[model samples]
Target: MPSTSQIRNDRTAVAAWTLSVSHPLMTLLVALWLLLFANLPFWRTVWQGVEGWDNGNPLFLLSLPLFALCWLYLLLSLLAWGRLTKPVLGAVLLVSAAASYFMHSYGIVIDYSMLTNVLQTDSGEAMELFSGRLVGWLLAVGVLPVLLLSRLQAPRRRWSRELRVKLVSMLLALACLVGIAMSQYQSYASLLRNHREVRLLLTPSNLLAAVHGYVRRELRAPQALQVIGGDAHRIAHVGAAIKPRLTILLVGETARAANFSLNGYARQTNPQLAKAGVISFSHVSSCGTATAVSVPCMFLEVGHDHYDESMARNREGLLDVLQRAGVKVLWRDNNSGCKGACDRVPSEDVSHLNVAALCGDGECHDEVLLSGLQDYLDRLTDDAVVVLHMKGSHGPAYFKRYPAAFARFAPVCRSSELDQCSTEAIVNAYDNSLVYTDHVLAQTVELLKRNGQRFDTAMLYVSDHGESLGEGGIYLHGLPYAMAPEEQTHIPMLLWLSPGMERHANLQAHCLEGLEDRALSHDNLFHSVLGLMAVQTAVYQPERDLFRQCLAPRQAFEGRAGASGAIN
Candidate 1:
């Protein structure tokens, strides 16, 4: 026998609970929690700011509420799409969770370049990234919330009314956010400037921005290819007899100059290259800090500032120009594809070759790039160029890059989980890969010298980009260029020229060696190649060419040229 007042109160309480359970506000709260929890790495970093308060200033506290409101704006705005909210938010959570796991585990950041690298990754690289850790994180943080959200029922409301409510709520949230930011502009600016990596690692936001940029740049139809150097042709000195020329452009992957002995590293990482008498350029930098950017940009006439992937993709590259000039060009790849740099030239993938000595289950040793290469070389005619794109020192499984015999450095990091290994172990593994690279380069030079009798030969080895080995708690490469550390940009470059090739270009070996310490970058690659092969084009800028100073004075030829037969 309950009293009337108590009975009425109980009914009211039940109605309130029912309203909350079925309301859009309740859904927004759930979405906010899902976003924050899914991005654990971001929250962890934010927690650091909490612990690092400046004398317990209350203004610093505003960041928390502002951040929550900002997320509310994002979530509610997304949810206003009616039934699509569940699917869209669920997908965002899953992707953000996966990105968080990798960023936390591998010390990587989510950026446009990283997104491009992810989308462009081959099945082999993708397979290597599969792990139980990823599965566990996805299930715990990504899938469970998605299932819950999918099961939850939406509030019954007219579409117009719902849209109006969503718009008002978003406006209120944004107003609060802007007010807070404006009030603490100095603090915010200082914090962001000092910790730039924070923006790149901020999950959900970083992921969204990266996805948007990728879609805008890569998914859309590209512009038509712009032909460059269409009037390219080679000219010969009258008295200097034409000799068959072979230049090997050895593109190394992830080799930093700081780790090479020839560049004054305390370790003897270049024992073999040192013995072979190759001149190592001590101050060379790459155009970009990632393979997807550097490989193609290195072969383009564009500099770092003006380098655009869209433009690079649409324009003919150095290889195309050389091929148009009637030079025989071949590209041999042991890593990933050439990223369209070799599309207009003859190219081969040696990673799939059947040489048991040089290949494993899915990938081949760099040595495989040399197998049957001499046959290809023998078949080429005069003024030839070959590019050997080696899979050198690509991480975090650096131990797999070299054979056991080349594992001179002991107690190396054997696991792909680099964080679990000690720093010494990681360096040992990375240095061992370099030692093997030294061996490979030495072997390449030996092979070139051996072919000197048939044709004047030269070899130029330059890494696409450098690697970061646990510097500033960063492992691997691909930080934004402005924020990139020296390790990611400063690369190793080595050159070897036979006496005959040197004389043909009117360059002395000692004179070229004297310029080893001069500052150079991937910007020099295009013009240098043209200079080496004697390809004269309207686009050839002598100021940009590394070998231009070494060449004898030229009386510019004014006529179309004919290809001389193979020099004998």
Candidate 2:
């Protein structure tokens, strides 16, 4: 053992050897380190995206890193103060490491929507995202840099001198950035324009921008709730003689259309739904690539093309409109809580229910949405709309979505760390979840059929968004809408109408079957529901309603009771 005096001397030497630098110098070095190591995803994407790179100008390739370094250095200079230097850079490094891992491991980009999804993710879902590989990645890239940063010290200088140095450094970085841009303006412009998502791959910059955007949006002044469809009133087609209509809007999660056998998948993913007399719309697309955006957008009359998140949050949606029209509206969710779409309506999140068979590991399967559903339906005596939001195929733990009995697909991926599993195993796990969803849908139809004597019932199932099961190396969802693949946008949709609903709405099953190939999307959801429920409002565009053309002329129902002013 060394003596106390010797130990003190050794500590003093170690302290003296600690790297010390000016704030500007520290920022520059950190920026360079980040550009090289923290942006592998960015570099990889750029390398692959560059058209004809083998024959392309070498100068263009050189300019890419030069521009990135200058950009990062200039941005780093904003917070490169004496005390804030290490802490800020350390935080950036840690965040960049996490962002880098996700971007590289799963081909996702950090965007406003993705950031929103992350912020809104529940503890159970967040837990599923945690993996050993992620911890290792963070240790290697995030924790190590932060640890190194702790040893380094930025020696304080005169305030005026420090400011001057930082300003000069920023100017130099800006100049280099400008010079690089000028040298390859066309190439840079083409690259950005063609692959707009590339910008969202930049490590710390992407994370910072996304967080900034989210904060700005969230901190903005609250808007007054805009109540729409004030003139809404449900028209009775059969007077008091016929049973009331009960429309169950079954919203599915992460169910891609490509995997749905009803949409022509080779695997029988939707076996139960296939035999349940449902009309599966093969060409249905989703409003957005994630539940946070898609759920609210689908409820808005404006549709995805014109969707404004702020506007949607402050406005009355389809459910509110239905309620205003005297249709009892209730939203029961097994997934995330309706993404605020059901805020104004009667909503229940049954995900945390402690039912023995359906609930375990802090989550209930999609079947839990059906629990106590019959009792609720039995109590309903009026025209009503019930939204059953199923946790259908929500991943990366696809196996957990279904019970073991539903795990008919052999050799399924049992772990949430999806990348560790073979693609075949992942698909098997996902398909099994869909198989469970199928059973749930079939059970819903059976329940509707059982209640047909008292109510004319229908079930319309549409997924909020689709999932990406390792397609193009992209796993999970929430790539920006423009860059999302068919697996992330194309969703499975189907309709099951009871015999009474078929006659009451004057909808022929064969007509709907023929219209299966008709291109539809979440845009049609708002108006189509209005048309089906016989709710008349200015927002109910007959042109957009899928059922409008399929319905017989008003003249056909003219002889019926309460038929006047009913068919809008």
Candidate 3:
């Protein structure tokens, strides 16, 4: 019935439709490859333990899905311009590699040396990055199917039997993707998989459909910032009653509670603190496992499960409450990176300032920050609160950071290459860092004594989280709470009330008589600061305030076994 030219065009149209449908399937498969590599918290470290790739650049939590979408977009955009070919493949890989390399070098840099070490061919860094067993597995598992699919599908194919089979196959592949996404514990509480990520994967028209849902929700939802509970703004500051001129709170980074000599660790890494009469709270626990989650949560009135809820009630934070009540709060950090906790607080990341002569250029010692505090205290009012975020044990290169003075015992490993070093060397290098951390605490106490003439002072110490020193071959922190050992979450804490500050604030009596002995947490730090200043917010509970009162002496370390991995 139709002319010859018309029949020829109709077949072309069907083929285009089949190819268009199959591109999404291709993108989904690649997305699965990237996601599997990154879901583990200690990705490169985990691979290294298996004698796998020495380097693995993790995709940001939202970046892997973006990567997949970009690949699909390239195919569609180029296909729109014309057909696919070898040059197009080359261009796509070039663009993707450029983007990935940039992110690898600068994305939050939990271990900057890990990247440098693995990428250096002379350093075997390149070998580690490329030859990791996981990467090999990915190539074997993912590349073969992809090569076959590319061979079978033509850009201008029709809806033939083979194409229908491909369509069904694509859906099956996507289902597997969904299953993998569902398998991760981080995804258990989230189903949307991030809206931006989903939109990125869809076609432009489909993306608009996805956005409409977002817009509808935005229109219907109430303001998230509105107060749902206690009025942090109206709360009263307890006042300048505590006697000591100032209080220093040292929040240590990654010093595990179990490893401290004060905790009965046979390692004797805590010699300086033991001599200085430091009473380490052997059983202190961290509220969360990661810095981004832990630091903000520690400063809020909300519990971990509802940290976002607290963000609404008060964006003001602990410093705000302290300032309103008239205690000057100053934060100086030489430690692991700061999360948003420092957003509204007066703070410094002195990690780059090599103040401790213990290590060379660019290596910051936590004690160096401690040495500088007396000058900072002198400038502040007598009734002040100073918080030092200490870089106690941020690791991988643990052996190189501390000075030989603190290297108490060792035929220690001298490099970050934990797998190549003996277990004792790994343990020695790590324990020496702990020894130095204790010294830093003692120096802080002596600084308070030197400034004792102006006002009474006290010092309280807490660690953000603990570290994993080669336990199960995972050599650092940030594992999912479910898989983390007690060493990685159990942390040390202490409180030494200066004679004057305690007597002046009437907290001296409170410190000596009001509180009972019991295990405490960084969760208590938020309310305790309020109680110390005497903030009159409804959220202030004595039972929850470590400074005001304690329940009983700390008992055995507690651990929760379920997926939440909450420590009791």
Candidate 4:
């Protein structure tokens, strides 16, 4: 029995609560909030990408926020159902917060390739990316919004009303989007066409689109493996008695050409390699800026331009072709797995060895790759190809890549938080890692020399991709190939052929040296390795072979030959 005024006050409070928590109203509010706060990175990119901002076009500028708002509202509406709105939107905000931190700080865009890199990254590499700043960003933009969202309670509505409201809201948002686009059709069309990457900079939309693409390509029903190089067979030298061949393909990670002294860098980063007389190719590019893409793409016969991750995953690549040709192939990894390149071949991973000197905390120095390697070579009784994937020059923990004894460059950045260190310190740590890689390569050469008496030996070293050390505000690699800085795409490649291998292949050291300035890329690797192994195959493209032009003549290797026997 309250008075009339008191009853009126209570009813007013209930009405206000219902209005605030109405599902459609809350969805619009959250969408607007995200448009203002969660999409700073997207707004920044748009502002910078537009030419002549001082005299900005009124319609174009008006369209920017209007389009973003309508787009976000429409996307959010799809998830604004009962009991699903808060949880799903909260997850998006958290993910968008993390994506924004990376996009703003590192100048990286969200795309399928970058998403593949993230999904393939091992625990060790992922841990290196963690920092205090990342946590702070999550707390501010991610956790706070999620907390605010958790407090909201959607007002329950009948099915008929809910459906009607959703339909009306979506139609209005769609109409607004259409209006904005039509108002500035020319400006909007030009901006989008000129800067396709801008679409990849939008916050949760880019992330969601990438996730959808990855799931469609990777998580779909498995396709049957496409077999290539079925007619592959090794051919022996005609005249001279052929000895067993041992070719080591050393794949380095994150090693750039600009830092290697052999490639004209001022520092003596390649002192050991230079003294070993390795032929360092000065001009070579990688297929991709990340290990996930580059490793698999380099192994494909299709090369980079025609490469497709799903197709590559379900196809026979270089190792499979080599194995089919009766050549014993093995892949030993110290970084991550071979990204499915070694799936069909025998492989080993030494990244978890517990050696006292070379390994600690579940990680090992690249030198651990040499352990038992010499023994394996000594036991070889047939032609074999071994790929040694080294953990070379990978950052932001570059200081940890080398042992203290090899830390020749003083004042190294010892922390994984790269932003905390000076550029000079970071370079010092990275250069020191290269020095250690040089040492490991030289030692590998010595091991091959020891086995030269029994087998013809050779080594080919090429990096999967390069790294970015605070170049143009880009700290790490994985930028899309078209927009990637030269520091991330230009990689180091070199060759070391034992005198016995030189004679067997009829390749002159002088001729190989003369071709150092020739432009090359990961595209040449497949055909070049086939040519180097003397494997005759229908898939082999002679024009793409690096050693094809250097070989003396076809007659030199056309002596009495037989089909190479498979080693079981």
Q: Against the true structure, what is each candidate's TM-score?
A: 0.89, 0.96, 0.62, 0.93
Q: Backbone clashes in each candidate structure, one number apiece?
A: 0, 0, 31, 2
- Model 3: runs farther than 4 Å from truth? 1-166, 172-244, 309-314, 354-359, 506-517, 550-568
Give lDDT tens digits, candidate 1, residues 427-489.
999999999999999899988988888888899999999998887677888888888899999
**CA lDDT of each prediction against the hidden true structure:** 0.80, 0.87, 0.55, 0.86
Q: Rank the candidates by lDDT, best first.
A: 2, 4, 1, 3
Scored against the true structure, residue 81 in model 4 reaches a CA lDDT of: 75
Clashes of 4: 2
Clashing pairs in 1: none
Better model by lDDT: candidate 1 vs candidate 4: 4
CA error at residue 366 for candidate 1, angstroms: 0.9
Query: Roughly what TM-score does model 4 have, to 2 decimal places?
Result: 0.93
